[model samples]
Target: MTNRVYVVGVGLTKFEKPGRRADWDYPAMALESGTKALADAGIAYDKVEQAYAGYCYGDSCSGHRAVYGLGMTGIPVFNVNSNCSTGSSAMFLAAQAIRSGMADCTLAIGFEKMQPGSLGSTFDDREPPMQRHLLAMAELREIAFPPAPWMFGAAGLEHNEKYGSTPEHFVKIAAKNHRHSVHNPYAQFQDDYTEDQIKADKMVYAAAGLTRPMCSPTSDGSGAAILASERFVEDNDLAGQAIEIVGQSLVTDLPGTLDSASLITLVGADMSRTAAQRVYEQAQLGPEDIDVIELHDCFAPNELLTYEALGLAGEGEAHKLVDAGDTTYGGRWVVNPSGGLISKGHPLGATGLAQTAELTWQLRGLADKRQVAGAKVALAHNIGLGGSVVVTAYRPAER
Candidate 1:
């Protein structure tokens, strides 16, 4: 029998802007979440055989500080920084360790404290000063057509022009996700926005209307999960309540690949598809079998494209699904029910793990009002800068 890996517990700090008098920093948030996860799983901290902590802005040795807060056990800990995908990457590593018998139980944590500034510089380092200037010029050229402020708008323009998608199509996405967010107590922007409200908001990117609510707000938060082998689960009596990690895959973008089609059909998506397919093969299931999904919606357009990449919809058909109300809560397949990054807020490293936490809740039927009825199998997709993407498939133990 194949050794299955199960997520026994998940924990997350409420997503919010840090108050001036907040007591916890990034590491503290991570520790608190990690402790909660252990408590939730009914496991002791000393039982964790290894640890993986993901963070972006929390200075050097951030993971150490968080682990130390739980008491300095001599377990091996590795810090990971893969931009937005950090959390999932950390989980991937933990799963591998458990599968390989390197460790029976592992803890994966993601945390970040938002710093005020443009994130472009941190995403790519290969750009020379002149190349940076040229990209700026290209951005200007893009703005001339769409009149939005951010480059994501330029991406939206390309997707719209290519796929015949509309601003209103994007607005519907915002509305659907916001409606979902209202059910997520941890979501930062839970109130719904009218399509008109989204359309009338000031332009952040000519193609991407500020009214669309493109980016997640900067914030400080953390999320954590405990992964264990099937042997550990059976021995520990965690069988019926576990969330199985059936598949995990990560892919990085090729260098100097600026083809518009490449961005629309990201390499990470292909990698994730392959990964999800492998998971299905292992789990004896398929895309049509999944009941819920938590995908990266760093921007609205990204979600539309991801629908195609994840095999939920065909290319150019994603917009149609949006128009037909197919991606909503009661739709055939529900995406981003946690409000996604759009309304849930993205704290860099924390997002990937946040997606996992949301999936866990959905699988456990504990998502409160956002829960998909009778959810059995679910998927979580996350992407990092330079086009790194990780896709994971999960199933509740009851199924």
Candidate 2:
């Protein structure tokens, strides 16, 4: 944060269910999204001094493959994967480059073309990265659910037990996100649903109150963002379009995560809280100053739990926020005006950048139908499971 960094442009594709878009490949998706981001910034790909590309299920050097179509300028391309937080990790690296005076212009790109249904481990031979997480869950409870859903679901259950939050709270989140998606053309699922319908949908993890409607589906899509230093923005006369990166922090799991033996810790609630606290401290702004947010709502409960983690609400009081309808358009802050991952589709690597795109639009007053009124400050949260969590705060550039 020594030097000012701004998001000069952002772009994302309409997320589609995996296999439904048979014609789309990672390279094509990356090319289209990257092109749009470059066009949005009114800059040529050759101007980019470095690039960070993120994906989970891609081979080595896939970052190069994805960016080669833009130009073979031979710029350094770093491949990144922090599980689901891949996109935000890429963005963080881009910001670091600018802050360190390494580059004035950098690109952060994330894309994923995933296999349908629940996410599973790609390798079978070695010890899985999630072994400790899985073991922690086993010691906590006996639940038969997919790895991702079960982990988040268990956190929901803990929230219910610790905070008196009910299934109704989680269901309300799903309903709100789905309703929000109705106006988001880029969402993978724009169909609206009532809370009753959301709760009644087929259960994925019943103990944790997770249903089909409450979970983000595997998707295929890409998102990209261009970051520039203050000098670059002024030199290029891009001030009008620049959104300042006021504060950002990335945190990983703590020893307490497993030692505490809490389901919430197992699912990154602590990492998110720690990261968000750091960002808020760095930005000299609290949650009250944020006008809009795009948090990682990979599952409904995670959204509810994140409400507390982000300081949007006090501990164990996130349910009250939902009860008061404070998380929607008419609420204190519009959380996930993009419909979130549950409705927007979680394309692994692309999700964090997609959240960035939505927040950028909101800060610039360009989000159109989903725009939050008078938005100036925005916050984004993206957490990866095997564990990394990034929290970033943004606002329109100062005149």
Please give each candidate's TM-score.
0.90, 0.99
Candidate 1 TM-score versus the reference: 0.90
Worst 10 residues of 1 by lDDT: 140-149
What digit string (tens of lDDT, one per residue) describes model 2 on residues 1-399?
A: 388999998989999999897899999999999999999999999999999999999999999999998899989999999999999999999999999999999999999999999998899999998888888888988867687888888889899999899988999999999999999999999999998898788999988768999999999999999999999999999999999999999999887787767888889989999999999999999999999999999999999999999999998999999999999999999999999999999999999999999999888888899999999899999999878999999998963
Residues 1-399, model 1: lDDT tens digits: 446789998889888764432776876788778988998789998989999999877667888888777768899999998877889999999888998878899999988877643354444657632243235437434434221124444555556777898766777887788878998887878888787777776555554554547556676788999999988898889887799888777766543434434434332455555556666676677779888889888777777767877888876777888977887777888999999988998888789889999999888889898989999889888976454788888987766
Reference-based lDDT, residue 181, model 2: 96
- RMSD each, Å: 3.3, 0.9
Q: Candidate 2 regions off by >4 Å? A: none
Question: Pick by TM-score: which candidate is best?
Answer: 2
